[model samples]
Target: MAHFTLKQLKYFVCVVESQSIAEASRQLHISQPSISVAIKGLEDVFNQQLLVRHHAQGVSISANGRRVYERAKELLRLSNELEQDSREEDELVAGTISIGCFESAAPLYMPRLVAGFKRLCPGVSIQLHDGEQHELMHGLHRGRFDLAFLYDLELESTIVKEALNAPHKPYALLPADHHLARQPFVTLAQLAREPMILLDAVPSKSYFVDIFTQAGLSPTIAYSSPSIEMVRCMVGQGLGFSVLVTRPRTSVTYDGQQLVQLDILDDMPDSALIMAYLRNNQPTRATRLFMDYCRTVELAAVTPLAASA
Candidate 1:
């Protein structure tokens, strides 16, 4: 019998993360119908309904689908690393590594890391792919990414996790004219009165939820959106303030919009950026070198003064 191919595994993982054909297609740079066909082909091979579809609500994985997802992920990871492993060991210092990321780190950190890594390892190349938490995780598991920057995910037996840096102080991104903008930094308690923007229902989303829960108040949320830019734009437009893990990059205009900083009542959450890769997968020399770069980068300590830069 013809077995599943790596291409099929990738499509499965993408759909699982995106939960919709159209979204996955757009992300993978494939046509929607092609993504649909790949998924149906996998279902036929497994002889089970890997995905359960709801017309309006989108798609979700079935119990059986989860099992396939986990195993296919490991296999994909193995295949991705195999080529890297075979390259000349020292030559491994040269080549490219793919990363799965989010707006949380991409805006500010990536530039610094890339520049620092380039200076140190002149031959290395980096490719970054950005998405939300679920999408990032799915790409990591599917072996499409050599590594990723993710929140502290509860990892599985076949994956390795390394903590990089703690989450920055959570702050309210507000319109420059908002009342809270007048203060240098406001406390979490003061934020209670304002309507806010927050993330959706996911592990990382729940983490943010807990931050508010611990504060002993539910937010007056007037807006909820998945895209980081949308959330920032909404908050910048005076729609509402946002409690986000990442701080604003600098005092600059975004799409001709202005943003102000508001202080939080509490310290930032204890969340950290982690480097995740398959445990059993043997990364190439390039991947290993990249991993070392992630661990050792000397990020200048960011403070309110640093934030203004």
Candidate 2:
């Protein structure tokens, strides 16, 4: 069967709102019998009773009728909205862009970036998704995201990468009393004999380990945790120590325990954070607008600092 006509739904709404066929006919600019015939035709197609008539009281909608009326109104509203949205998108006044986010980037980088983008591009819509490095990269590869932030992205031959922030140098997290804590910076050789807490979820752990290997120091992993918070908490308690490249200032603590930021004396890690996009995939205007904004606000050149540990 053909879909119900928009006219039928409009006529139904009028009848329901007026609660009388004669009034509906007057408002709809049609005869009462014509309205009655359309209503009867709809009820027949639905195979359910809708309006019931009483002598002087006009018509009252049944339960099923009320449900259909509500749905029809929603459909009509949505249809109008769809037309308006199409018009805006065609004019580049409104559109949607999806972005992929890495764990560290979203926490420290994206909050301000998004707010700024919205101010410049008020008509565009942004969709945000947060995930680990590999997960975010996968989304970018699959075209699931228009733009993405990934860390230490060892690129294939076809991807584009741009430096977004300063290279985050890894530092040894140690208690204030530890002998290594006295130095302005710590080297891999200095902490080689000590136990270390490794954060499994950190994408840069392997790179940091490689930095140690090149320096001829083998770290002994005394504890392992998947959560960054657990790693910080363990480091604070002096259970063990770890090397972190990118950490929020809020996580750096000068309170409970005396901690030192020992700069790695070994060869620094090569993985620098970057904003990447597929080389072959042409970006939409909205995507380009957002990318430009990240580059703009980032002109202040935010540098990573070591506060405590």
- TM-score for each model: 0.66, 0.63
The C-alpha stretches of model 1 lying farther than 4 A from their native spots are 1-92, 119-125, 153-158, 299-309
State candidate 1's TM-score: 0.66
How many angstroms is residue 3 displaced in model 2 relative to the true structure, after the best TM-score fit? 14
After aligning candidate 2 to the native by TM-score, how far in Å is the CA of 172 from where it should be?
Answer: 2.6
> Which sections of candidate 2 miss by over 4 Å?
1-93, 251-259, 299-309
lDDT of 2 at 4: 69
* lDDT tens readout by residue for model 2, 244-301: 7555554344345545556667776556667787786656666776777777664323
Top TM-score hit: 1
* Model 2 score (lDDT): 0.70
Q: Give lDDT: candidate 2, residue 302.
A: 38
Q: Best candidate, lDDT-wise?
A: 1
Clashing pairs in 1: 186-263, 187-265, 188-264, 188-265
